[model samples]
Target: MERNFMTTTKPFVIIGAGIAGVHAAESLRNEGYEGRIVLIDRDTQLPYDRPPLSKEYMLGESSESNIYLRSHESFNTLRIELKLGVEIVSIDAEKQIAITSDGTIIEWEKLLFTTGSRLRQLQVKGSDLEEVHYLKTLSDANNIRSKLDNVQQVVIVGAGFIGAELASSLKKLGKEVTILERMPLPLAHILGEEMGEYFLHLHQSKGVNVITGDSVVQFDGTSQVEKVLTENGRVISCQAVIVGIGVIPNTLLSDEKLDVDRGYVVNEFGETSLPNVYAAGDCAMWPYRGANIHIEHWDHAVNHGKCVAKNMINEKSAPYSAIPYFWSDQYDHRLQYFGHTKDWKSTVLRGNIEDQQFTYFYLNESDIVEAALLVNQPKNALAVRRLVKQQHPVHTDLLSNPDMSLKKVHLRANEDKVSY
Candidate 1:
């Protein structure tokens, strides 16, 4: 038997019309959900892809229409009521109603929060000056892109994926690019120090001035930023600056009644503590590998959205167990990563790093593959993903040999069962 809402006309409302929200709406309809579905967001523009905003979109290679997640006709065809430039001011969970910023009360049978995240702002002297931008939405990208023609020198205030991608794009645009990272090595937290050094060298070789172990203490200029002051007492002159330090989960809607940690706490099925409430994407921390983790990546968001939508309609859907995957494109190199591991005893290299074609495999004490990073080696992507999932023990000698394929290494079952 269907639920009570299935028999009525109450809409299934999803807050935040991002990738996750859009995917969830489509999944609901595809799963035979016949009720009214509404997707809401405070952003005035149509939902667009964010990853390209720092790359192709910034390089003037891709237009706004090309980046849009869906066209108007597509949403209309799916019967997904999209409410853009609309903000939900408050929610009455017991009453199953949400009050909008315009004082419109919308009743819903189930509520889904995919609010995503907000960029971490830089707070210091002259920070409020014009030309200091943070890229998160289409509007933010437009703001940065609009000023590129007048900008000859660009300073980026982070060495994370977005910041690095932006540096590559800006350098390609013929601007003198400078990157300021507080960490000793860029992306060391995720990619490790060795790979992080590789990125530092990659940027330096392209004529990008990368200054590590220093952070922006202040921005100097009148109405527009003309220079940046670092904590290490180094002053760098620049025409414009883009801050891509990181992002914090946008959980402003969560009240005392809702559970929230680093993000809105949700189970593997995307269920909250409250009945008929769900959360996904960057704003949700779901169970993974015996602990809850928030994976702020495009691929994870797409998968999580689809998985949650299934459980929203049918309560007995399978728990989400997809392996964590992420990719980044910088200059002419493509890096693909599969699985996640914070603790690994050894890292085995299979290919040449100096040639920029290699795969780094993270293995535990028992020689079980936990994660693998493929750089410019697209041919090994499928095999690497499968190897990580299988979690089979393999000889380091086989793994280190370039001729020994990953697919052939884990063929034999180990007498010792792998334990996490």
Candidate 2:
């Protein structure tokens, strides 16, 4: 929904002012690109990290200034031109021009569409109530905070990261929280039923109401949220609500010619169908291990931005093959995951899921470490990430033995070799 058209072609232009976009611009400068750079976004404020919005920022654990991507002085010193709060209406690849809602044309030799994603809107009734909210921007967090007063209980529709993190934050603030999820258990589809059950218990232990296999069909109130009606006819009374069903990648400017799958399709280099035109962050479905995936993880976004910036400057840059990783913070637990295993044949359970501190590894038919989730055992992630990246075989005994040296796991590959 957002950027400008320039008559004279600039050196580089980046769409979206989120983490990926800002990193791309900074990478370009770091790579010694002295030409003019333009960064555009719909936000009036400078680019700030989004991960904290649902956790630290919303809980008042972190301040706004602490989350800023970069200082204003740095941007000014780099001679970077920032066009904020502007909507890019359309882009004409034929003429290498982008038209903005502000009736301006900006042309660039290289254009990066790190356009990010828009929060998937709830289609149910009474979703437009003043008390209902979706967190995507700093303003959204602020608005949620502004309504915290007098809000006795809040109904959160989706138990994904955002909903889970926010639920934990709300509980800390002494607010009664109820989570409604259509999935059998929270994050079940992604983490499998076993680990999902662990999370279900994690929330239940925190005193927040966790309801699964049920969903909100509608909200009822007189110009304000009063109660949420579930599909099963159970009504949850609440003063406020937050919906985190999921998100749709912002691909309004993808155009007819560009390949658009679940997201804007891009190759290993992060280049779109159009040359010198790139897409990064959550908007691009990137190639990984003979598969195309749109990983909306914050770490993946930052890496994509950095890789794309390099490839945009020099065509011979290395292809991006980094394994996708993501983490979630809820209460006292920190859940960290490495690689993708959306479809795996076997899941090797390591550590104790009951204790809420463990590592679960996903293996294919051949027993390769395709993906892993470390529950409060992030110390085990580095080895898992390396193992997945190197495509090493997984011996259940090694993973099963908790006393085994995780740091020396990589050494097994070279233990028998002599350097004579």
Candidate 3:
């Protein structure tokens, strides 16, 4: 399909108002695209950041107001129209128009689908009970917060970052927490089996009933969640059940012909197969770092938004080549992982695991693939990310030395870019 080269005076319609959509809108303005912008969201409130919802917000350390990425005044200042609480029922790509649930039809020259993703529902008996909840939106967070006082025992399904963080928060609040994961080790698929086992020890030591290699087959209750039944017939009674299985991409409104694999498939420039339509964020599946793979990290979403915005307004086309980086905060440890090490052959360990202060480096042959799972050592994470991005090979003995700073290792690379 040919790229839409003709710039129009008509408004650019963005389907969602989450992090990706908000950043895209801001980027468009920054690129001098003064054309009218219409941001449609099914949510009643303004766009907000989701990372805090499972962490500080759940702990009551941050308010909803602070969670918002942008203010309504800023949107007004930019002359961007905010249509909240209105659901787009259908999108006619042929007509270049969108029809909302309330009979509002929005005509557009170019459309950006940043609809984001929805929480995957728990598929088990008694999941319809009132006490079972899934965290995704701001409203879900508020609802979950309201029940915290009464929820003494909480059973969390899935052991991903959200589940892990939520378990920590609830445990801190004096609630008895239990996490159930179908995998043998929590986070095993993402952080490697060794690191996953380390996390298992961390949570178990914190007094959480960590159940692995079991799937919840039923939620035994009358009107509210009473007990969670595993496939092995084991029962876990709890006052509330929080499910964090994962999320599914929201691409129902896009052209059906568009190639969608897990998410809305797009080129490195964020252009879909359909003309005058683009995608970004958790909803987008685009090539990263010249590799034919899609990433769902927050940094990827924000950068994709910026790139899509630039391409939407400028004559010059830029390819998306941002490295994927993600972090998780559980208890006192701040785990930061950089790059994709799915195919790494060996992992080099630094510092003492027993002391709870260390970093792990994943290597593909002699090349540094990824690194820096910092417990208390975060400064090294920056250097490690740089080294991995630069593909600078280091001596295994030098990297293993606890006294050796990453700065010294980069300095040995004969690159003056590494400042003391």
The local distance difference test score of each candidate is 0.90, 0.87, 0.84
| Candidate 3 residue-wise lDDT, 1-420, digit = tens | 222322245589898998889999998998899889988899998899998999899999999899998899999998888889989888778878878776666788889999888778877788899889999888999999998888899999999989999998899889999999999999878778998999999999999999999999999888888899999889998999999998888877756767788788888788888888899888988775545565566777788888898887762387777777778889887878778756677777889899998888888786555544667678787787777777766777777888887778766754533532
lDDT of 2 by residue, 1-420 (tens): 333336465658899989899989999889988888899997899889999999989888899999999888888887778888888888888778888887788888889999998888888889898799998899999999989988999999899999999999999999999999998899989999988888899899999999999988899999999999999989899999999999988998867688888788999999888877899989999898998988888999999999999998897485998889999999999989999978899987777777777888888887777888998987777787887786656566776678777655556633522321
TM-score ranking, best first:
2, 1, 3
* lDDT, residue 363, model 3: 80
> What is the TM-score of candidate 2?
0.96
Question: TM-score for every candidate vs. truth?
Answer: 0.96, 0.96, 0.93
Clash number for every model?
0, 10, 0
Scored by Cα lDDT, where does model 2 land? 0.87
Query: 1 or 2, which is superior by lDDT?
Result: 1
- Residue 202 in candidate 3, Cα distance off native in Å: 0.6
Check candidate 3 and list the clashing pairs. Answer: none
- Model 2, runs deviating above 4 Å: 1-9, 413-420
Residue lDDT tens for model 1, 7-46: 2367999999999999999999999999899999999999
Task: Tell me the lDDT of model 2 at 225.
Answer: 92
- Candidates arranged by lDDT, highest first: 1, 2, 3
